[model samples]
Target: MRADRLVSLVLLLRQHGRLSATALARELEVSTRTVLRDIEALSAAGVPVYAERGRHGGFVLLPGFRTELTGLNPDEALALLVAGSRRGAQAFGLGSALASAMLKVVDALPESYRATAAGAAERLLIDPETDLLSRRLAAEEVPDAIAAEVLRAVFAGHKLRIHYAAAADASPEWRTVDPIGLVTVRDRGYLLATRSGADRTYRLSRILAAEELPEPAQRPDRVDLDRAWQERSTRFRSGGDQVTVLLRLDPARREELAGTALAVHAEKRDTDGWLRMEASFQDGRHAVWALWQLGLAAEALDPPWLRTALHDRATALATRYGTPS
Candidate 1:
């Protein structure tokens, strides 16, 4: 076990760059003395490991000391490659680099292991097209990256210089702002921030540029994201523009509702081995979608207007599916 630990220690130093004896001891669950002993053992075995004294010093491998990855068995090499490949690193502009590293690891394998790795590689398939699209999306290819960066800065409490295209404003305008956070609805992302002047939600897709200020000051600790989300949601639910609808859901439907963000607006009860729930939604749009998905499990609780609206929508859909009369 001690000998195996020595090998593991060497690998850690080689892979993770450097670590203090205390760090190594904690990782290996051994005493600092034991870590030193292992380092001596490694040195005795012609492994180049050394330590520096004082602050900013720790265990370091001699430059150019390489651990042979081919030392891994065929099964191990294949597993390593598969794991690396699964990280979608290629889509994130890291595929070639990872692929190169995998090649080096595979080259270190013995002939039998090489054959196994080859077989696994044949079975391993990287979905190039899907990964490309996913990577592109994640890398801010669709939305303006500068806008996203500004929003992120706001979330992080950093001040930003933003070139914005407002909904009402025509030309792009620049302003300095203290960002608050972002809200994502459906596929669109909105940046909720406070300009040096006021609170607003900027469409991330429309942001022209956002630059971080030097040594940006911290925002007030009073900004509570949960409180903001709740206030926004309440306004959406009770605002005169959007109709509030109540839903009476059965046990299965109630249980499902209890697991959502909207659960905050619901009241539940036990009813003869079943549960009854009342839920309020901000807009009929989402409510209607939920009703269509709930099938027969959910029923409208109140508001004659909502009932009529649902009936009319259902009838329209039914007529569309029915034979021409």
Candidate 2:
């Protein structure tokens, strides 16, 4: 591990000519003390590394020092750089590996195109957590050790024993499943697997623990994960406890309603110029949450339960605010 780390340290310095101890530690995912020790190690190993003191000063390597590794063209290097900026790799416990690989990619770029490619990559953003509306899009947290074990099982073609909690408050249940693939959508990781020959997808965040079994998994030699994921998604959307609701929506908010619903069964314009929609949602809770987001712009007409839920929530909020100080 130290050998790998030392090599990574050298690669890091070789990639970015100058970086502060703090900066290096941040990039290395280590502490400053560890970084200092590494610098000494590098120096002892004859790495032409040195330090400069004062503000705007940091560790620097001798000029013209280079590694033999090379050969990414401008477009290839730019593509790698752009891909490296994404956060999905972290979900699979490959964040450090990705960082080291990106550094190597940058270090390998022909100087003629290195800076230009990096600059171009910097101008492009991929799968940013937030949108133009400024709403925070948070990723679910998955423990690295658990994710790593799951990844190991997936790659090794072994059955995985998982302690999974179907809901936040539920007790974890142990299950041995043959992992088919891993899929991430909207930053949430899911493990696609079969338990007792039944398709089951478990959220990575809800996995309390994971153990890779010695027995080889019962899975196909090759899988089309993309197609598998799409089919699973289609089944999920169509098989849930669906609640159909008639909604009177503002024309401007029609798209928002459609976006939140499982399906917009029908849409028509009322004489009053309001958009009427028959929409199906996954469940009662989903319907409530979706309609709540529209405030007064959307009204749940047919579903008495949905209307009652909205009214209750509104009344509770009003009562809370209306109470005497």
Candidate 3:
């Protein structure tokens, strides 16, 4: 939808020659802040749009420049179609709008490329629900009413009050935050905000309720969401209680062990062909669970407590089956 709005901004400038941010916002039916952000995006993308400082002066596009669907190459057009087909757009409540935009795109393209591009895009699959191993990648569901409140708050730059359940065992509690933006990673939606000047990220699915406050959000006018997400992700990964364990694993299952570990500190093949490895996990429980899956194929060497726990579990299992219950 932002893409469509940006294109409309360009078209308006091309048709009307010059328009103030307020005027553009009025025409586009959005806030002047949104219009300003769009203008910045356009400039960054190398569109020849400039502003004049005088009271009467506004934003103007350079003379003799034209925008048409022909500007997009076959690959570019196909890429757009493929992206439109993804479920990410739907996460932001823009699925139908994106579908409409894609239809317009196909209609605008030359007949020769239109059918070919559409057909090619249909042939390609992006982000299928089930992966190669037949495992379903469940998309976290956020109620439409909750998502709508958050969206309105993000766009309006207002403080947000949310009843959030921090954990499954904990009851939902109300908290107020200054919202920065919404981020979706692997089909999971997150609201990036600041609470009492400290960064916070909340899962959309966990929000029991949301209310947009009338007060303006205490946040910067501009934000680099990608950078923000990276910083938070780094801190989250490095923070928390980490557990390290040394193990002996079947060479074939070494990869499987490493895949679930937070970090694989070291690994080597033993003379007997087993893999001697040191791995770290989010917690001791995480380490235990990952290693338990391999059964006899994986052995925890270090951490006497972990080895004892696994031994106890295996003994209990063997005893259960050794004689009829």
Candidate 4:
């Protein structure tokens, strides 16, 4: 761990040119005294690290010093190159940073593996603008200023004030929240925060504006964001108005039904070679809508309301098309 910390210290200086002990302590999650000790150790080990004494003075390396820390193998290099190609970083306003980091990684890689890894990464497409069906996959546009403020609050453990556009309201409402973390899933970004001690996840794209407050965040010193996100997801999936329907469907349509259903409680083959499934939906309307899409391949066996809705829809369609007009 000490070795890793020393390497990180060197890389930080290399990347930022110079940094005060306070800044280094904050970035390394250590203390100023620890940073000073590490600086002395680096100097003792002939790392060419020097300190300046002045109002703006800090630790810096000799002008021509660079670390030989490119320890990645071919596969690791390719994995990083592929990760750099993803569009998810754009949601957090790190697209340019990712590009610069990738260039540095490539430059540091062994010359024999660098070109091959980059060429392979280019051939593997991710989140393409247009898919085979000609459907476009687009990422939400988050304003640079808003994203910067959100990031500042998250990293500095400060509170944030945001003007959020709720779907039910016509105008955006201002709310002060303690940002726990920022998450980017696919091409969308979400800010996981707590308002009045209740957990909330806000889409970054829907945040019309944001401001980082000077007040420290009211949250646990250490947060398990992944577990918190999972708990919230479980609550959302189970808290909705859910309805279950029994259906007999063609075996070939099993995937279609499963894809549309919230959950499949049971599945078994009937005596007539049809697959019977008990599936849950968001509500009766959702069940009816999904069944309608299957047409003749699926039949709603129970929950007479769902069957009636499907029958009504089929009758209306037949009446309209069977007319002499």
**Best candidate, TM-score:** 2
Query: Considering TM-score, which of the candidate structures 1 and 3 is the better prediction for this target?
Result: 3
Q: Give Cα-based local distance difference scores for all models.
A: 0.62, 0.83, 0.82, 0.81
| Native-to-model Cα distance after best TM-score fit, residue 268 in candidate 3, in Å | 4.3
Query: Candidate 3, residues 1-325: lDDT per residue as tens digits?
Result: 5887787788677656799999999877789999999999999998999998897999999897667732343323433553643666556554444544554565567657966886797898878999899999898777777887998899899999999999877899999999999887778788999999999999988998999999999999999999999999878767899878999999988778877887788988999999899888898898889989988899999899999989888899899899876
Q: Which runs in model 1 stand beyond 4 Å of their true positions?
A: 1-144, 151-176, 181-192, 201-208, 213-218, 221-242, 255-266, 270-275
Query: Higher-TM-score candidate among 1 and 4?
Result: 4
Judged by lDDT, which candidate is best?
Answer: 2
| Model 1 C-alpha lDDT per residue in residues 1-325, reported as the tens digit of each score | 4754665677667555789999989777689999998999888989989988789799999987866632443323333543443333322222233433455565556646866876887896753434444653242222335643653576457787777777635788987777776655433456666665566567665667778776563467667776776776665556554444566666766655554424345555646544445555546675666666676776666667667777898899899989876
Q: Model 3: residues >4 Å from true position, as ranges? A: 1-85, 250-259, 268-275
208, model 4: CA deviation in Å?
1.3
Q: Candidate 4 has what TM-score?
A: 0.66
Clashing pairs for model 4 are none
State every prediction's TM-score relative to the real structure. 0.45, 0.87, 0.67, 0.66
**Candidate 3's TM-score:** 0.67
Comparing 1 and 3 on lDDT, the stronger one: 3
Cα RMSD for predicted model 1? 16.0
Q: Rank order by TM-score, top first?
A: 2, 3, 4, 1
User: lDDT: which is higher, 2 or 4?
Assistant: 2
**lDDT of each residue in 94-123, candidate 4, tens digit only:** 654454445457557666786688788779
Judge candidate 4 against the unseen true structure and give its global Cα lDDT, from 0 to 1: 0.81
